[model samples]
Structure formats: C-alpha cells, structure tokens
Target chain A: MSETRMPALSRRRVIVTAAQLGAASVASAFLARHAAATPESAKEWLGKLAKGEAKAGKVSIKAPEIAENGNNVPVTVAVESPMTAADYVKAVHVVADGNPNPGVASFFLTPACGKAEVQTRIRMATTQNIVAVAEMGDGSLWTATRQVKVTIGGCGG
Target chain B: MAADVKPRIKAPATAKKGETFEIKTLVTHEMESGQRKDADGKTIPRKIINAFHCKLNGREVFSAKIEPAVAANPYLSFFVRAEESGTYEFTWVDDDGSLYKAEHKIAVS
Candidate 1:
C-alpha cells in the first residue's frame, strides 16, 4: 500500500503545480490590467506606501512564516507611541497581498488606548505577504510585513 | 445564535488605577470570502464581521472595520489604560448586522 501511495502522491503534486502555474498566469494578466488603473498594485501596496509618501518608522508586525491552517492565521501589530492626545497612533491597517482582496482589517485607535497594539487572525487563500500599516497622529505612516506559507490541500479546497 | 459563532475575551479582571493593561479577544465566525460557491453551486452570501468596538465608562477606546478576507474565528487584542474602575464593553458587528457583545469590569486597588 505504501508503494502504491507514493506514485499517487507524486502524480498529485505534479497536477497541483500545473494548476498553480495556470492560476499564476491568469493572475499576472489580471494584475497587469488592474495596475494600470490603480496607483499601487495589489501586491506592492505596502511597498508603495513605504517609499516616503507615507511616514516611516516605529511600527512592528508579527506573523508566522508558515501557517498550517490557511483559514485562520494569527497576526499582531504593535507601535511605539505614548498614546497621548498629541502623539498617539491613529489607525492600523492589515493588507494581504495575493489574496482575492488584499485589504483585510483597519483598526482605529484613540488616546484612551494608552498603547498602540492590535492582534488579529486573518485568512489567506494561498501563500502570501501580509503587511501592516499604521497611521499616526502626526499624519505619518509606518509599516511592517511578513510572508506566510499556507498549505494548499486543506479546508475542502 | 449561529452555531458557528464563538466569542471569548482575555483581560485581567482587576487592575490598579492608572495602570495599563492588555485585552485579547476572539470570535468564531465564517467570514465568508464572497468569492466561493456553496455545495449547491451557488455563491454563498458574504457574511463577515465588519466592525469591532470597545468602550470603557461609556467612552470609546478601540474600534476596527474588518473585511471579508479576514480569517475565520477572528482574534483581536489591544491595550487600554485604566484611569478609573468601570465596565469595559466590547461589541462586534457582522456584515449581516448581527451584533455580539461582552463585558468585563476592573476593580481598582
């Protein structure tokens, strides 16, 4: 039985790769068209935001490099701030590059929070980069990101 | 009540006045991606929790708008400073307009 399963598993892998390649090709074409209209590509939205157009520095995001479950992956963002009326963090946005929809969560924070920190779990259709963007009271933006690898066969996919 | 929805809160039930504390929360939800089909080959209507808000002493401290792409059983954690002892209220609103709420109190020593 083990010998018989080995060949089947290899065949399944080949099929999966072919399917993924096909999907990637389709996605590339779609992105090309979409990018023409939007200033930022879906996958590079964070990078665009980080190129001095938005304030940079003092934000950190923690996420797993590999997620065993794609349906629910944990994410956390923390910012260094006094959380005072004058210097508090304003908002934190979570974006998932390569998902059907990249924008995942946007958190609005007030000085009453006393600290700028948020943790949440988000879904990923496939392996992708998750970016966290934080807006500060001084009209500045900071960001951090990590890549998450998701297993493909689970969740009835 | 939806069989799939589950809610939990993690926070210290007691804290000293003027102390800062962290709060963690999670809810079990489908958070349908709106891009998939059900078993009947029909598009499953998107039902996701779009907003979460926490209020202490009738004052807002934290709020968030979640998108459909958020993972199932969403977990959110944040920090708050306890200036005075009062009830901390947490509410989660779904895209379908369903609301889930939880409350925690802090006793200042």
Candidate 2:
C-alpha cells in the first residue's frame, strides 16, 4: 500500500508543475502584448487636451463604497474655487483607471456657474479607482479620486 | 442638435439676487462602456459624455468630469448662488468632443 501511494503522489506533483508552467507562459504573453499597446493609447488621449497633458490635483471625485449594480453608479466631482472671472475652474476630466477607455468625460465651465460642483451617474466595468482632474484658469491642475467596489460586472470586461 | 443628442436640464427660472438655488440636469445617451458585446458578440465601442459645466451670467461656477461608468442618461444636480439677474448656461461635453448647451435666465428683484 505504501509503494502504491508513492507513485500516485509523484504523478500529482508532475501534473501540478506542468499546469504552473502553462499558466506562467500565458501570463507572460498577455503582459507583453499589453505593454506594447498601453503607452501609445495613453499618449494619444492626453495630447488631445488643451494643456497637452494634465497633472493630478485640484479636483475631487465622490463615489460609493460599494455598488449594487455595476450598470449604473453615481459619481460626483467638486472643485474648490472662487468662481470669479479672474480665477475659476476651466475644466474637469474624469478617468476610470481599469475601464477599457480610461478617458471618461471632460466638463468645461465658465464664471457664471457661481459654484464648483457637478454630479452624475456612470457605469463601471469592475472594481477600480475613479480619478477627477480639474484645470483652473491659472493653468494649474488638481485632482481627487475614489475607489469603488463593483459587485456585478457592467462593462462585461 | 444632433439627431443622436438628448439633452435635459432643470433649474429655477427665477431667483433673488445673492440667493442660492439648485439646478438639475440629465442627458439621454447610451454611454457604451467598451467592454460590452452586442447580440452578435462584437465589442461595443466606449462612448460617454465626459464633462458637465455650468455658468451663471457667462461665468463658470461648477464643472465635472464624466466617465463610462456613469449610468446612461446621466443625472446631475448642484447648487449655485445667484449674484445678479442673468442667464445660467449648462453645457455637457461628449467623448467625441461635441458640446450640448442649455440656458435659463433668472430674474432677481
């Protein structure tokens, strides 16, 4: 009985090693492909903005701790400013870190708003951080972010 | 307005000078998440309204960035203090860089 158990244990070990190697190869290939594509896409989107690029700060993003429905999630962004013509929030950009298209939305504001807050609802593909970047009239950037746990997959990614 | 555009906004038609009021807005859009598949199994391209901005008397007071995770027909409500009698402008920008603007004038006495 002991001799028979030895053979079975050895066979299991071999199988496990084979599976681990196969998984590692697959992961490496995926990483290589993603590495080749990500930077180009990021550059394309960032270049389209007026400032050519945005730094993180100046904007605040609000989202729930947990979302029951991934299809519809509520999000809000507020920027601190005087709302005066001389110095006001020029625009705000929302980006979803794990979403297929990271560049989410851009809002352009003027001095007539009298406040610096906006609220809306959006869809999240998975659990990830939502980032908000605000561009002010003085050509400076500010940012705020929130991490939301999405229970059900909405984007189907 | 584009044939594909649906815009909706709600704010006080009138308010007193130096008073605060709430404004609400919603736009009808598909807000494709780019991760979904149609019945045919093709990936849906991500398209969403990326930003919303509001102006009072041609001055901006509030703005936000939108994302694909935002639910369809995005709803936004916020407050603004009316400084003088003038028009409040609301603009929603889409991912394609199109702008949808609406205006409401307030009378201050």
Clashes per model (N, Cα, C within 3 A): 2, 31
Q: State TM-scores per candidate.
A: 0.79, 0.69
**Where is model 2 more than 4 Å wrong at Cα?**
A1-58, B1-6, B45-67, B78-105
- Across B1-109, the per-residue lDDT of candidate 1 in tens digits comes to 4666778999998888778899999888767766667789787777788999999889999999888767777788899987888898899998877899888888877
Docking class of 2: acceptable
Candidate 1 TM-score over all chains jointly: 0.79
Candidate 2, residues A26-87, lDDT tens digits: the string is 99855432222243453455456546456666567778999978778888888989878899
Q: Using lDDT as the measure, which candidate wins?
A: 1
The DockQ value obtained for model 1 is: 0.59
lDDT of 1 at A90: 86
Residue A17 displacement in candidate 2 (angstroms): 7.7
